[model samples]
Target: MKYLVMVQGTQADYEAMRGKASPGSPAWSEQEVQAMYAYMSAINDDLSETGEMIDGQGLAEPAHTRTVTLGDDGKAVITDGPYSETKELMAGYWLLECESLERVTEIADRITRCPQPEGAPNYPVVIRPVMEGAGDI
Candidate 1:
């Protein structure tokens, strides 16, 4: 089976990483950033060697996002960020071909341990099986 794993974080967290002012947390240090990248690269390498990784990518900050919806007349309506109503934004995702949900959960668990600023809370990794056919959808 294939599973999609989504990583979520708060807007404050994103801003802090980018050297912007957030409410409380300080900006991430260079060593912390490097460690995070190293940890993610190691996990990707492991997943690739195990034939579990299909695809993965990190997303830009929510400040750059836009929300689109259908207007009353069927035209597209657009709204700008930074999605004030929401506390968390999707940070990244990974697609994995694995044997079972348990296996995927294990992979997500490892991701949850990826390096972050000290005292930073662990974020949830949302996992869902990928539907490959119309019937499944």
Candidate 2:
């Protein structure tokens, strides 16, 4: 099964993360950051060892996004973004090809437990299994 692990959040929640959540910050409490890093690293290592990890990446802030839309003339319209609704923003994602849905769920649980950088508290990671030719399953 293939899965897309989405990191979703609100604009306000993200602004608060700009500090501790920013790249190369020592702002995260040492213990908390260490624990989460260890957990994430372990998850990655385990998945790689099992040949379940296909590809993955951490994203830059949503503020860097650009939107492309079709205009009446059929030309592409480009614009700066926070994208669609600022109330719900997609931060980042992971693509995994696993053996079973159960395994995917296990990975999702670990990701969801990742410590949010200070102000972004209790943020949840959502998992969606990809449907190939079908619309929805």
Candidate 3:
């Protein structure tokens, strides 16, 4: 079955990785950011070679997002993102075909161990099954 494995972060986390730190976020050096990229890349490479990775991507910051919603008059209204500064959002995701929940969970576990600055917050990884066939939930 296919599963979506995701990692979440706040805007502060994104800014911190880019060398800007807010009140609750820690700043990361260029070397620190590069190390994180290297670690995530290695995982992607390994999964691809194993034929488990179907798709993967990193998302842009929430500030770049746009929202579409139904207006009171029923027309579509567009606006900037609704996320607050500290709102947690998906930072990245991997679509994987795994034999079982255990397998996907294992992959997510590996992702959670990716390199970070010593004091950086460790956010949990999320996994959800994709409903592809009848009766899937």
Please write out the lDDT profile of model 2 over residues 1-137, one tens digit for every residue. Answer: 78988776554444544334433333445566577668777877888888888876656667777779999999999988675466456766778898888888888888887764544455567788888766666
Pairs clashing within candidate 1: none
Model 2 regions more than 4 Å off? 10-15, 20-38, 83-85, 117-119, 133-137
* TM-scores for candidates 1 onward, in order: 0.90, 0.71, 0.94
In the range 4-93, model 3's lDDT, one tens digit per residue, is 999998888888999998877789999999999999999999999999999999999877778799999999999886376547888899
**Against the unseen true structure, what C-alpha lDDT does each candidate score?**
0.86, 0.69, 0.91
Clashes of 2: 0
Q: Please tell me which model should have the higher TM-score, number 1 or number 2.
A: 1
Clash counts for the predictions, in order:
0, 0, 0
lDDT per residue for candidate 1 within 66-118, as digits (tens), equals 89999999999998889668878889999999999999999999998998776
Model 2 lDDT at residue 110: 80
Shift in Å, residue 17, candidate 1:
1.0
Error of 1 at 120 (Å): 1.7
Error of 1 at 100 (Å): 1.2
* Candidate 1 ranges with C-alpha deviation above 4 Å: none
- Candidate 3 TM-score, C-alpha based: 0.94
| Model 1 poorest 10 in a row by lDDT | 17-26
